[model samples]
Target: MISLPEASLLALFLETLFYGVFFTCYWLTLGILLKKYGIQRDLLLPVATLLLCIATAHLIIDFVRALEAFVLNVDTIGADAYYSNLASPLGLAKTALYVTQPTVADSVLVWRCYVLNNRSLLVGIPGCIVLLANGAIGYYIVWCLSRTVAGTSIYTTIPGLITTFYILTMLISIVCTTHDDQDMTALISWRIWRSRRSISGGSADLLPVMIVIVEGGAIYATSVLALLLAFLTGSNGEYPAMDIGPPVVGIVFCLIILQVHFCVGNNPQPHSPSKSFTNLFGEQGEQNVGYGIEQMIEETDRSV
Candidate 1:
């Protein structure tokens, strides 16, 4: 029942809030990556920076659009009219940024999965195909939106494309979440199971589950799922959900890196099981963890 202007204002407010959280996490993540791997040794720093830039741009665009709607053009075009004009440059730019941010995030995720599976062609092929499809559909949605007449509801104009785009978004997130959970679980569980004879604590048994929980992509996946549902149900909730997507992507990306860095750094005993576990992520095994994580740990140990 919310009007388009109300939804736009609400979305800007929520996006600003999420952007604050993302900025904090992003800086902390940058610090850790710099201390552990520096710029030359790791690609994650650049990737993270790219994500931050995109998210910041999205936030700024939202702010500008909100200002134009509620303040600058209040007497002229009016708030509702400003927001309802989807073909405006700012509107189109916002949509393009939204599409780009998630595509980059999902690409990084798929790359991580490929690395985790030791660069297997099977994993790489399927992931690339899905990623291409995702990008194509996402941009196509943007293109469709751009061509629609002003003040028309997007859901009404191209309902099928909107639905397809969100479904693909959800599908990508779900696939990444599933692969991350399964791979992390298998690696940690196998290690703990092997070392069970030497170790005596139930706490160690929980490490696999804990690591899987921390590293899993469930948070991003859940958000996308919620967005898809909101869109499908034709609710105003989709506006805020769409607005939150960029920051959510950044937050999830940074959290995974930060978690891995601290988890490795906290247990630095020379012969600790955690060290052995970290080692398993290197080239010696068929199953690998993310390159950034492995490199961060190695560099941290060298500095110590």
Candidate 2:
């Protein structure tokens, strides 16, 4: 039975904490990408930067809204009244940021799936359609919110649309993560089978699986699923979940890029020129397969 203002306060606190973590991860990931691939050659650097900027903007907006509610307007409108105004300019701006952040994150996940699946139209097309639907549904929710009167409960106004949007978000995450994991697992298994003689001991046996899970956006998917469940159950917990989402998105993006960079650096291919991480996603390409196998074998040997 937490009130809207109480929920908003909790959400801001949680978001601030997570944003700090996101900032740290962002810097670390940026440094690694720049050092390994440089700014000009890698698409990931730009994507990571974009996610970071979006998350930062979202955090700033939340802080400003909170300040206006609890501090600036405390003697006049009061925190509860301020927060209950669904169509407030700050609230609308925050909603817009909320919508934009995940769309960007989901787009990147879909692109990763497409690339990892060797540019398969089957994967890319469905993902794009889902992404578009998710984006449209999100902005539609924002529009509905913008039309609500002050003190209107969001659940009353657009509960179905919010639920649908969360469901779509979860779907995109699960679908893209599944595709990435399958493609990565297939590539790793193929490499291990090809270089069976070179791999010995179980030292590196789990590394590939771990890498696949991390790179495939398992963390993001899990977070979104938790949020969806909370929202569906009519819990105030959804406040914190919704607020932390942007930072989580940024964190996942950084982790994927950083994991790939680390894996490549640790697994050197002496027989050929170093392969770009982007190239490793093309499991169907012969050159990619050759490079991937060599790197896996090298990593296995190092582990042994």
| Candidate 1 per-residue lDDT over residues 1-304, each given as its tens digit | 9877888888889889989988998898777666643322265677778888998999999999888887899999998788778788888888888889878877766665565454568876887798788788878878877887876886686788778877887677665542211223333334434443244343334443345444555677778788888888888778898998988888877766555544531322233344343432322221222333353344434544
- Shift in Å, residue 89, candidate 2: 1.2
> How high is the lDDT of residue 64 in model 2?
94
Which tens-of-lDDT digit does each residue in 57-109 have in candidate 2? 88898899888988999999998888778899888888788888878766756
Q: Using lDDT, give the best candidate's number.
A: 1
Q: Which pairs of residues collide in model 1? A: none
Task: For candidate 2, give the lDDT of residue 243.
Answer: 88
Local lDDT at 46 for model 2: 72
Best by TM-score: 1
How many residue pairs clash in model 2?
Answer: 0
Candidates' lDDT values, in order?
Answer: 0.66, 0.64
Off by over 4 Å in 2: 37-42, 178-207, 214-216, 264-304
Residue 157: error of model 1 in Å?
A: 2.7
